[model samples]
Target chain A: MNASVTARRLPIISLQDVRFSYEGGIEALKGVSLSVARGENVAVVGGNGSGKTTLAKHLNGLLKPSSGRVLVGGEDSSKTSVAMLARTVGYVFQNPDYQLFCTSVEEEVRFGPKNMGFGRDDESALAERALKLMDISHLREQSPVSLSLGDRRKIAIASVLATSPIVLILDEPTTGLDSVESAQLMATLDVLRSEGMTVVLITHDMRLVAQHMDRVVVMSEGSVALDAGVEEAFSDPDRLRRCKLLAPPITVLAQRLQAQGVLPKGAATPLQLVELVARVRGERQ
Target chain B: MMRAFELTKTKVRYPGSDFPALDDVSVGADEGEIVLLLGSNNAGKSTFCRLLNGLVPNSIPAQVGGKAEVLGRDVRRTSVARLATLVGMVFQEPDNQLFCMSVEEEVAFGPENLAIPRAEIIARVEWALEAVGLSGYNARSPSNLSGGEKQRLVIAAALSMRPRLLVLDEPAYALDPAGRLDLYALLRLLRERYGMTIIIAERDAEEMAELCDRVILLRNGRVVADGPPSEVLSDIDEVVAAGVSPPQIAHLSSLLADRFPGKTRPFLTTDDAEKEIADLVRTAGSGAP
Candidate 1:
């Protein structure tokens, strides 16, 4: 068979005009429509009350939409059980303490696949691969509860990764990590993306989005405020500010320089800005 | 004036652990000063914060050595309740710290337990809520408030005690950029107006450079670098080697300086970097870069 048909991309997760309200009748998500293609890296960013978490909850069947529909892998989310969706989409909550219950790191990582009916050997293999991917192989024997927040976060992600889901959703994964730890985690995600894993990252850190993500979905006041490529999404700071978000610091610096006519345009990452300055210095010489 | 707190040769070890959580760490902050803690995870940032609030050896059972003093009280000898009056803590996860149903009750809980007069407790509750920019949220439930609002409420709960020193652990890690700006502004107000000494452990250098006066870097439970933000954070190589990334503006300035030697001076914050870059362009005869 020719590879053309097999290589065709389709939406892995789709939210069609989904609307959701919390228990107190607070409408958290107001008519959100979006789609995620397989092997894509997307970031959902917004203020606290903008319904980013509410929208994510619908993807894994944690909350059913009040109106419209949520489709995961072309399957109706409301009809499928959360357990069934877990096989396709692995969601790691913002807090590592929420889902971490096992004693040892290895046990925590292997528990997911074991419950999913994988053989003991297959479970060990999956756990080992995930631990290695997250660079936490050395901490396998340690108690997960006693590990540092950064290490525990890695264990949480590895545990989810061990299930071998087609799509991974991480909420504020770098909340308690340093720059190096955050960079290392994002690099691991890059490696997974290169291997055809679809990732949906929800965070407030714009630098990560500017450097790593290709697409950004900005939420505001329980609505989809802006959805575009990274450069376009960050190009307009006023629009992002209205959404209660700000461009990354390096981006803002470049914008300030751009306004002064020193540079033609602003850049999203540090390396790009350095190169632009280098080009300008070369031209002046 | 006397120092707000002083920690000397402090060491902390947890049960069943091969290594100490904090190994012979000695650090302190002055009154009305904002000190920022920079380090990777398990670098004893939280442990240090706990030491100030008497949670290290008092609330949590851990092997301790050396001396810790908060507001002239010995941390190892004093009770956590007494130290609570001198030190306030705001943790990364606000939900774990907040328990009251209404916003006002949460802030009043600490003062009420201390047997403060009814008139004083009411005034404190009002002031604490207003201090955190949650004045109108007094009647609302903590569960119903947004993430930023909950964080403010937690801070209010700490402030209600009228502590002299405040310790916050990654307070803005979960907040949006706007919320973070608001938090930093409030922190500045506390230091300037209220004269409260603040010690915070945060990972975001971009935001901390402007708000903090002193910067301390911890690695493997040891203080590697400690100085002012201008000096400590500007050295990108040193900061990164200590297991923390420097601010983007600092890193950017370093890169430009590398390409054009002696042309760019080190700047850490966004406000400073803008001026530095514009000056470099102006000096280079800017036409089109």
Candidate 2:
């Protein structure tokens, strides 16, 4: 492999003029074109029926486009087998119950690696490491079916992580999780990104998107309404309103303060917002 | 009237679990009040909601102790069907509860099972749908509705029973922010118009703080904190330690407490925080120093 040639290769996942419709003629994706580079933390956000999930499915070859093309790892996704693509992209469903069927938590996490044809020793190591990363190593012996939703979600992510995919797609991973669990899960994803894994998250939590993700893809009526960096995505109010989304509460506060010239123009997380407010107070005194 | 529901030192352990799902939990809500249950997953919030309608003891095989009462009926003694008449329950997943062909049928299923009069059932079906802002969706298939619509349909079905109290276990789990706002608005409507007591088990304390009259914080199957939203949410350390993040406004107020002195108070919504900050800036600009 030529090092510079490989470095300049196309995006890891690319979709051009992709359109998809369900069996009953319900158009889910109209004409969405997007490109995601390696090791990118991207968040897909929109209203309930704006086709965020549909677009995610195409990236993993779960669904093929009606028109145009989807390329995964520089290969045509539609021509590739989903099983073959599974090694490169691991998709975690929103509900763990939809995918989890193993007897034990350890077995559940090990299933992905085993299915991907890892050796027995490697499988065990991956499973153990994934479980430990998710903070669920203690539940390795427990039945996944008997665990709480939050714990099951962690198990599902661990199972996907055990597969060691370069690209990870999570569909609303924090839907039922509390703030602490959400923060912990995001931290795990951050670590994975640091280790050169690409993460694509589908979520409705603006706070998570603003604080965690580097890029944002806003979907509206099956098309890409806005695709920009985290700051740009939240700062653009018109596009967000067009897609029936709002900036995180902290961002909204910052915007209000900015309007009054109390704070400089910028998007801030809750913690950052506090620091900004304190700085303004100090300046006033 | 007596409190809507009260749990007195209630404890529940599942059939195979070693630890209790709910450990000596005691809480109460008044009539026509909205209570938000804030906790991390497996903190007994669902178990507490189950106890409201006898699902803990009657349906699930659980070791139970102490007392639970809803609408003057002991949950331990009352049949699940009987408790359903007074305590309406909506679960997290709407698909789990919806089975009828059409929205009208789905709404009427609850009342029909209760052996309500046919005329009253029809009236209730109409009333419930209207209350949920789905008045014209009676003939629509539940499968065809959006996630938010399905959730509202479930809420309508629960309301058709005309229960005095409604308990929802993470009802907004599947909804987007817009959908969640609609649901919260509908919940406030339900409380104001129908005088229904509402208990919501939620993870988003920020959104809940603006709507809930009181907040109940649970951790490790125990009640760690219980008070009005302002007081309960303002204790940032306690709330965060319990694995529940306080609302952004509450966090901001706490951060600004030293700077703003006595003016800083727990705020539930962005508008509240904005007003306080704007006031502070105005005072400073007018030569307060």
Candidate 3:
């Protein structure tokens, strides 16, 4: 788990006593605190109304906290323009339709870089890199409306990545994606992490947390319920239940076998079927 | 009862596209049967679903050819208002169909739109909510509910319409594991208890194989395969080529079927696969690899 060492060197983003309420007087975030260091891939997991999206919006200055502070690259987010925030932290909305405003994929990918005042040649270079990163380089001239929903989602992500933000926040990135799209997107996130991009992925998929994240932070009712390594977070099924999440089938089966005396107690969460087979074989050995 | 007799032989062409979204396709569904439509995205799965409720030719831009009937009525001729009473549709995105302030209102919208008696509307709303296991959610706002709750609410709204068939187009695609489980239970209850002919356009091959009585495999708007899910899903290469994720246990069994050929079964659920494996282990004894 890429837990911060000194909160320096990588004090890229931090939330202090953050609270948010909509115009209708509904409190979405309540005194939430979080810190994300540079190069850390931290997954924020929770139920639907658990303030994960609220927390994510704060990271990129989309939704400023009411009574507290949000620090982006050690600068107070409230004082910064969204234009400036977009350069330091890129936010990808869950529904691609909400974000994709351009006509063609190439133009969509170049929108952010162009807005950030890059010249035509530089914008083309950034757009090419982003589209290649998303593996949609061939779709440069295709109309955004003509692409599949999965492809549109990737274009939205590519548009965000074109800005070249150090801290990237994705809200429910895998929603509505088929298994193949989910795998491809997760691989892209893995590559992004390897490139020293700090990623805060907000999602409800525990399998995603188990497979991709460096750390998993559970949120319940607008508060941080559990913050720990992925193993530690997924180990406690009850805590996961409280947060309204479920372990993958393999992990549940392993736990059941352990309970039924077919396997040793304290069996780890098995992410894949091979891991479960290995666990059972080790126990028999 | 609700039955489709050699139905779905329709040719649908989208706007400005020469190719049919669904080519000549035919299938049938019986009352109390859960029929799973398995295919990848843009495989005319959604087009087939729209054909069920007559939304294809009515609201959407499409030219549907041939006879596509639902509940003994020609879908092309049947008005959407009349079709809604026979086949209720729950779309993939719950937000698109929902606009009511409270859960009760959302469910009641269908019955009230049909001009059902207020007393009967309340009763139907209650029964629908109970069927979806959201009995006490009448006072709750759909906007504030979880993704699963909103999905179930959509199902309840369809149920309140007293439809003979329920067509769900990827209703659980956006949900988490627990939410998906809840939706599965709700679908099962609709078929078993209420005798609703449930048609699901799904990508989860294993779930369809286990829960559905029959499977309809569509490819480029054609009925490539139509049979019991066991036969359709057992062909792993076909399912993979169609871009469908095979059931986890079926995948595992296929992996071991090379070494232990007889142990292979068209298993969908994890426990069923485990039981089959355990029984095989006992029979094979030390010969198992």
Candidate 4:
């Protein structure tokens, strides 16, 4: 491969020994190093105060690292303004109320594009496209304040998506959503990922990590405890324990069956467990 | 048994809205019962909770019809200030309800407003903090606590009111798994020690099923199913179609039931599902074929 092409193919987001601390000398992140490929879907999971949110803020220049370096789109984050990074990295806060301020849903979605200096027509087009993507087109004229938590969350995400960032970061996106809405949101994220957007989600829902994310990053005590593919991450009991994280229930059941020699290893999902049990039964018959 | 609260044919239509937020809904909980309200967004779970404390018609401009009674008083007739002494509500966002400076002040604010004796208010604040496992956090600032701690503080503040019924709307939505487990244990402790009646509106059916005595499923502002978790959550199709996910164990059991008819029962927890799967494996190992 050409050197320039390989350079272009470098990870879309990279952190080299990043460290962050609050004003009270409390370190939120400690010497963390990670990289996200161009279009990977990664989940960051941990207990409360485990630095997942802090680590996410570094990707979009919302928080400058105390030491070390963070590179977004191969540019040094410390040298770039959050407004400048907004064109390539869009962040959704855990509480949609924190991000939603526009009177109407359509206006909320257009705020980001308009802030990014897009022309009036371009901003409207982007906002309309984002509204349709989030399935909230009908709610365009409705005030976001009068909407439910789920709808407000959708509006928050659509607002960020209107900016057309290459890397999208969401903190606890499924916190207030029901299962169906959560699944729908994940499907929409998958669609965005397929369109070459890198998705970084900070979540406590282990089932979502297993079902949607391609890779998992487990944080513990302000550090990265384990980073691997979803299956590899969930299958390791010690790593999960170190981070105070629980494997998905289906994974737990599969692990027990694997222990009793009733099924093979590495079944982390419900569908996988069913398939494995069927295969074992077939062999017995 | 005494009824903690009851609603009959309740309907609430907000001002200028075409559809009613709550439509002909009826549900009730006995004293000391732990009831869970499960529904998707805009399914009227919060509306139903608001009606319990007279917030629907008293505060918000809504046309509420039918009957809503809390602590032996009609909600439509009782004032919100008076209902505060009978029913305590903890909303989803902890920050929204917390305005006091210190944790002690937050817990004491409610009782102090109720004009309880100064000594009694102090005692209640300490008791509430201790009940929620925040005994030493009296002087800590609410902004300095973690999300889970803030929620616990809110619960403690509600507990200080010593209301007959406690309603929590998605209290554990922002908590982590461990935090959720802690909350479940705390709720159980409250039920066991204080004999408090808890009504939780949550989407995590799996954990709530294990904790709550009754599960009420709502759809489009109406009750679709109301029963024990074993019966209501077992109907995976209905629950999922209503935009609520059943427990993973229940989903697994349903799948197993499809594979082997009449041999499996829906489980609400991992332990029961584990035992069921173990027995199935053993039976398969035998010479049944």
Candidate 5:
């Protein structure tokens, strides 16, 4: 495909034949190999029990791959402790309750920086930066439990971002988020990407893959199925449906019309719908 | 046959709070009908749900003033155990209600609490799980289920009781998009197949507009707007001022209205919006103003 090799310039994470299993011998990930560069926004998509979350845990050294190797900035994931890896890889959980341990929003954001041995000034600065980035700076003194689910999610993201990790991995980033919250979150990730941070988002939302991610990695039955550009992967609806995923409505409409000889077949993404209409009109003319 | 009279005043105030959590709220839902409650965070939607099942004065000691009747019994005087047969209340987080190890046990807890027979409890459990599309997960542990499955399991638990009114308080908030769709499907089935009266307190105006026949909008603990979904959600500026997102299609429609002046007014759902758009295109093609 003549793909550029720019992603290999400064590889931050490298997984070689990575495989993982829970305590009960349920294999979650198998023979997975991928590399995440310093400033890449790679999205991992799959259905239930497809090992996306297991892969997320491996990035932060929380769960060691059972049979293979995972490298985080050249540090062996199996050998490094979670506390040590926390500085290099930040993991935001899907459920805010799991990550939110502090009472107040400010306390939650400050926990990571303080634990990482930052001084008072640096800790407060990181907390402020994280809170502002998540857009929950107004709720700094409010109790985390009392906040709405959306606001609590922001606090959870802020807590993770305070660690200032080189790589950010969020599992199911848009789960249960409304349109506004989802857009705000994607925008925040976009800002972080501009700031040169590596973002690895695990999601089932195809719209997110098409709109936000640079690269797409489709997982299935504990293995990587497709690792390609966002546009390339989502162009095939049959493949996506096989994984129990559906594209956005606009994209699906465009694809159906194209397949029925009503529009050009190249118009697969939603952004190309308008062009598809124009091309069809031109053909008629 | 369920009804309420002069239900004009029911209030619940937390200790040391000047204003009540629920203030002077009066709403009704007839049998075999779905009523949606729409509001922002801390808008007393949950409080109203708790009131339906007599959890206000009986369990939490709310200052219940006005009369609220459920299945012809005064809610203020009825015990929660007795009222359990009429109203089933599901909270936002399913994990809060699920304490049992297995799904079978979790769904059976309510019926058992009501002293139903063992055989009847088993039957009810099976029927409930089947209703929510969790038939095979009876032996599975509640903790082992996924987020979607767990929420369905919660719905199954509520359905096992066979309450006439199923009151869900933002049941889809913790679920993913697929999970939300599945929940809505189950709710539709409950309304159609079983003829259950569904009362859902939600912030998603689009879903409520599609699913419920009537939506009762609450603001600052008062019933501000109560009518059909089309009437309630069409007023976008008012809904926004009440601190809630209007329907997605409605929002887009309003934006379009600003651009295509005198073309189309906003609708709540995508189907209606599509029809409106098609009509607009036709009218514009016909040389309308």
Candidate 6:
């Protein structure tokens, strides 16, 4: 295996010893290194001010690293312009208001594809599909500014989706959404992931991380504190605590059960825990 | 018994909208109670909150109908500025409420608007910041603070008002796990120590199933279900229909109930689930051959 040949197979997104600092000399990302393979669903979670968002900004060239390199599709991020990178990566803002400025939702969704130089027919097709995916087709005629927060969030996501980027990064997409809306959004993302879209979700909601993401990356103090499979990450509460995070309640319950010898040591979700209990009762009888 | 606030048949319709934002909602809370409002998106949770502080019809201009009385004052009769001194509101976008240069100034803005004494305002600035765990952040720029820190600063601003009622709209939406836990602890402390009544709107009843006094479910701008956590949250069908997810413990208990016949209703909190599991595993261990 030649080193040159192996470098060609670099992850879809990679950060090489990246360090970033704000204008005031405050370091946000301190020598952090990370990578995401093609079509992988990864959750980047941490407390506020932990550099999760900073690390994400580096992926799409929104913020250049102060001391290191970032690679997108085996290309140097520093050499790439944001407009050029927009073809491959779509970054959604946490606050919908920051990105939404169009008078109508339909126009908002079409703005991205049009700006990307898509033809009139291609723009309409993309915008319509994106609107349907977010279940906001009816709201197309309404003003994006006057819509509810949840609807505005959907519009923001639809606008990003219209561009049809292969790699999508959502920052706290479900913070203000209710359970049903969040579930719908996650389900939509799941379908897109199945169609070979790389997803990077920045959120503090561990439940979504456990249910939707296959891998977890914990950030703490401007560094990657832990990166592991989802089950392994949630199983260790001590490691999570060191990073100022906590596993969801169901995971904690599963850990407690494993400690008491009620079952073998393993990670468990809500349904998994219920199944374990029923299996134990069956064996006891 | 004198109630802190009461709304009977409260109905509100925004300008040029077909459906009412809040439709015939009747709910009330006594003094020093922590009531939670749970619902899905566009489910009128925020509308209900705005009505409490007279922002719906007064400032926002909506067609409002209903009797809303807060702390013995009718919401319609009171001016929003006067109501500000009585009802402290923390909007969903808390950053909008913060316009001052520093955290201390932001908290002092509310009390100072009411012409509070200079010494009292100074004392309030210290007490409010300390209450929200921002003691040393007095001089920090509000814009430079993190999202979670900005949320706490707004809460401190609300605390400085010393209002009889507090209506927080998804106050923990931007907070991390530790920050969320801290916010809940602070709310509990307010109710326990200072006898403050808090009405908070939340997306789900996860950790709060064990903390709040009453859980009110809203669906399509109407009151769907209202009861204690164990009674309301355990009803998975209703909670899910109302667009809110029940606590994980509730889900575990519901499944356990289905597996084991004749078990009583589901449990809502992790503590209750822990006790049930300990008894369960102990039984399983004793029968090993």
lDDT of 3: 0.80
- Per-structure clash totals for the candidates: 0, 0, 1, 0, 0, 0
Give me the runs in candidate 5 sitting further than 4 Å from their true place: A1-9, A43-48, A95-128, A131-156, A172-187, A202-221, A225-285, B1-7, B134-146, B206-208, B265-289
Evaluated against the true structure, the overall lDDT of model 6 is: 0.85
**Which candidate number maximizes lDDT?**
2
Worst 10 residues of 4 chain A by lDDT: A1-10
Candidate 1 local lDDT, residue B114: 99
Off by over 4 Å in 2: A1-10, A98-148, A236-242, A265-267, A280-285, B258-265, B278-289
Per-residue lDDT of model 6, residues A84-134, tens digit only: 887888999999999999899999999999999999999999999999988
Candidate 6, B171-276: lDDT as tens digits: 8876788777877898888788778899999877889876799988999999998888778888888888888887888878887777765543456666678777
Local distance difference test scores for all models? 0.86, 0.87, 0.80, 0.87, 0.78, 0.85
Q: Which ten residues in a row have the lowest lDDT in candidate 3 chain A?
A: A265-274
Clashes in predicted model 5? 0
Instruction: Rate residue B222 of model 5 by lDDT.
Output: 88
Which of the numbered candidates is closest to the native, going by highest DockQ?
Answer: 6
- Interface RMSD, in order shown: 2.4, 2.4, 4.3, 2.0, 5.9, 2.3
Tell me the chain A TM-score of model 4: 0.92
Clash pairs detected, candidate 1:
none
Give the per-residue lDDT digits (tens) of candidate 1, residues B1-289.
Answer: 6577787888899888899988887777778889998887778889888988999889898998888788778889999999998899999988888898899899999999999999999999999988888897888999878788889999999999999999999998668898888889989988888888999997567867889999988888888888998888878888888788777887887888887788777777778778877777666655433
Candidate 4 CAPRI level = medium
Worst window of 10 by summed lDDT in candidate 2 chain A: A1-10
lDDT of 2: 0.87
**TM-score attained by model 2:** 0.90
Report the CA-based lDDT of candidate 1 relative to the real structure: 0.86
TM-score of chain A of each: 0.92, 0.92, 0.89, 0.92, 0.89, 0.91
For candidate 5, write residues B20-82 as lDDT tens digits: 888887767678777888887778888888888888778977687776777778888888988
DockQ versus reference, model 5: 0.18
Q: Indicate the residue-level lDDT of A112 in model 2.
A: 90
